[model samples]
Target: MIQPLDSVIVHTLTRVITPVIQLFALYVLIHGHDSPGGGFQAGTLFAASVILPIIAFGIQGSLSVLERRAIILGGIGILLFAGIGLLPLILGGEFLNYGKLPIPGMEASARRHWGILGIEIGVTITVAATAVSIYYSLRERGEGEEK
Candidate 1:
């Protein structure tokens, strides 16, 4: 596990800011279709929030929370995206044809909008989970210790 930093201020700030970063990430994800930020950017932000704590407090704490669930989260993301895409096909439309997403009572354009939002959500989850998983895999096994 990586060693925690000794600076109390950094640790304290990390604790305070992580949630804010995560909330911003969600905002970015939600507004992506209408603006510049989207799933990848938001996902990076989310991952950075988790990574900040790891950098400040070490992998020990983050690992306990992320270790087993990261892959599951990734899978959930994939399934959500694929399910939404395939659903259009099952409803007699082309793959990823968001207008056919079968969300009853919505007009085609609204269905399309909601479908795209769901896709963005899936992408956000997948990218964030993948980033954290990669960070864990690439982190130093142990720091400042004899082999």
Candidate 2:
């Protein structure tokens, strides 16, 4: 995405605003277990935090931080889910059976939370990328149709 306007003022504001969004994302991720917010919300917020720069400073600036990392992040999230799901099998329960996570301090609820966090991150990445991809595609298609 490209900024509609280029100005030093917008750049300065963007510098100030991006960090706040990032901190909120972290809050959502950590406090998610007992609250209404969680990884999905946080991940998209994270993506949006990055995307805002794209909208304000253009793609070149957005790439400096967010880059093409969403794809890799999605993969890592999947791996995390798989590892958590396998924990049950390692401890003699069936796949995805959370109670067997094999730690005394952690309960199945924690497992559920951990496993869900991974899934949510994966969901967020795919969703955020897909949203941007669709917008770009449709915009391009619309332009082509005008010819």
Query: Which candidate gets the maximum lDDT versus the true structure?
Result: 1
Candidate 2 lDDT score relative to the true structure = 0.66
What's the TM-score of each model vs. the native?
0.90, 0.70
> Clash pairs of candidate 2?
none
| TM-score of candidate 2 against the unseen true structure | 0.70
lDDT of 1 by residue, 1-147 (tens): 455898989988998999999999999999998888988999889999988888888766576567546878988999999999999999899999999998899999999999999998999999999888877666644443434
Q: Which stretches of candidate 1 lie over 4 Å from their true place?
A: 63-65, 140-147
lDDT scores for all predictions?
A: 0.86, 0.66
Tell how far residue 15 is off in model 1, in angstroms.
1.1
Q: What's the TM for model 1?
A: 0.90
Find the 10 residues in a row with the least total lDDT in model 1. 138-147
lDDT of 1 at 45: 95
